[model samples]
Target: MFKTSLDKFTSINRIAVISDSALGFGSPDIIGLADGLCAHFGAKGILVQPDDLNRPLVDINFTADVRSVRLFSDLPTYTRSWRWNFFRLAARAVDEFKPDIVVVVGPNGYGASRALRHRPKLLVYYMLEMATTEPLYADLHKHYGNADIDAYIIPDIERHNIDFGNLHWRKDVDFEGIYLTAPINYPVPIKPRAADDRNGKSIYFGHIHPEETLLDNMLTPQLNDCEIEFFGRIGDADRGVIANRIASTPGKAYRGLQTPEDLADTLPRFNFSLVTWKPEGHIGRFHLPATKLYHSVLAGVPIIAVPNPLNVYFIRKLGIGLLMDGWSRRSFIESIQAAKAMIGSDAYRSMVDRCRVAAEGEFAWSRQVSRCAALVERALEKKWRRLYGPRKSQPALAANG
Candidate 1:
């Protein structure tokens, strides 16, 4: 609907985005930014999601009218299968659309290879979660192909030196700067608490990846004090067990899926938010992009993140929220104790103020979509630069090979 309606004022030649399994892609943070960019920039955007993954999320997709955005499904059987289908359709999309650039919000080397072979300009956005403590070991020399593809990485946890490389990835431009992906671009239909609804409680939400489930015991002590509202799709069977136990506990509410509007009302009542655990792996350490922090920030609540590489790095920079060392009960308790001390202190209020600032200025989708649009525009320019460059070369790599 949006794609067809957009031709009068703007012309988005072509752009591509693929993030999750279903591909409705309308999360409050990322998709909101992407859709807003396409609309504001007068560019047409088509999101590619797996058919199997998309249908169930129709309600979520519609929450912000993202269902009206253009989309085509060539979704596959499984993730590995999705890769094959994704690249193939992506190639066809590029060929048919004849887009100025091909983009993937996450690291997509396979698509990069195709985009490079097809023409010249291929844009890749690497959303970073943790830089120093978390480690994502992609073969910089291998997966990245060559230096022609401008790489922009951020949430700049490991700014100075990290796993990727010391030398700047850009050939001549400084495209690689710290960027904070905005939370979803919801219409703000619901108003937050009118200041009297604040209640003290520690809560966390988001994916409960297998490795991070180790921290469930920490809540046993505090589950009795206040509503320990735990929400999210249980990642796996064992994680479900952990979630079920916590949810089953008295006073701990497992308030199932709440719409963005519901969250606006419900979240403001909670005094503290939780961001716990880092999986002991590459992807876990380096990239933990939790929009919950932005949610907590926006809700006027502080995040109680685990004391790991990611949280340590964020506090030192963004200066928002507190950290619990280890997902251990002692650590969580002590941290909240520290938080209580600081809550009445200047530092805590300042953190709350900073969170609100980030929610409006740094974390909101309105500003982020524009920044992303700029990046997209720049990436397309670079692509064109290489496509029509004096010496740009194209080597046709095997797609299904």
Candidate 2:
């Protein structure tokens, strides 16, 4: 199906993906992009990441070869000196692969620079967060400014405008960037549940920060009518606290970490997915796009999100979900109440229909693959002209000759 997507760029063969987080560990975009490129172009690639022995390795069902490099230490150190060692190890793997394009995921300054040393035809940076206030990100911005990146891929344009617009690097006249949200594996077949069959169940996945997300406050008796499920990673400190809270709640459960494949089967069983974020600090202000939004839609389920501009924009644009009016616990309760009321209504069914439509079109990862290919083609064209000047017209005397 994707055979024609890269017909214009046949010269492009192999790709290299470098990231601090390993595939299926924390970086879903990296996994999707690498897998999509392989499926689209029928290209071979290599994935190089730091080996985290603490976490079990996830089996990523992709075409690329995986290489894990052990970092000097895993003690949450962001110092350039420490990261440089990782870069050195990762670069060796990348060098051996000899990719035509190098895509660096996340804010790894030394790693990005090291990848550039390979002098691939195209260098792409995929920004994971817009937390400019963080010292590590600020330091990495310096490396990003100096690196000769051919293109950039961000989660969405709103986050870029809010957090990265003022950066000097983004102002370059030649800068090329694309905003892609978390993509759903296509052909998943969205099957919206019938109204009569619906139950008042909701889900919250990804990081499970009890206090930061006000999830602790929302788990009271007021929301006893709805059943909520929690999944994904949690800090060691908060695990016991969150587990106790879930246990005390009448209809709450913590299902622990499940793979994306497993969640694909589980998501459709819920009526809505909760897209909550802390209403303050860098996370709140930047409001990075939530992967759950697409995940919900892909399963023919709607979402109930807090009042973040990006989330609100998509919810309104697609009419696939509801947004809370405020960040207080009362607002959270009200939003759930609102969703519960709409569960069996025509509006709710319409939302489900919209999700199916979106999953088949906009939310599909295949669409992002096409756009990514197009961006690479554009970059390759510019590179060709820069190396060997634009094609010249032949003399006009062919007929006369």
Top candidate on TM-score is 2
Residue clash pairs of candidate 2: none
Which 10-residue window of candidate 2 scores lowest in summed lDDT?
181-190
Top lDDT model: 2
Model 1: lDDT equals: 0.53
TM-score between model 2 and native: 0.85
lDDT of 1 by residue, 62-125 (tens): 2222333223445554455555555566555545554444444443323323443355244554
lDDT of each: 0.53, 0.68
lDDT tens digits, residues 1-401, model 2? 35442343336678877875644544566666776665665677776766554566655555444333333456455566556666777787777778888777766623544445567778876666563656766666655573477776667666555555445555442333433434333223335565456556888887777766667656979998778888877665867877877867888888988766676677788888898877576642546677777777877889998878778888888888899887888999989988888887888888888988877777776677678777777777776666665567878776664
Indicate the TM-score of model 1: 0.72
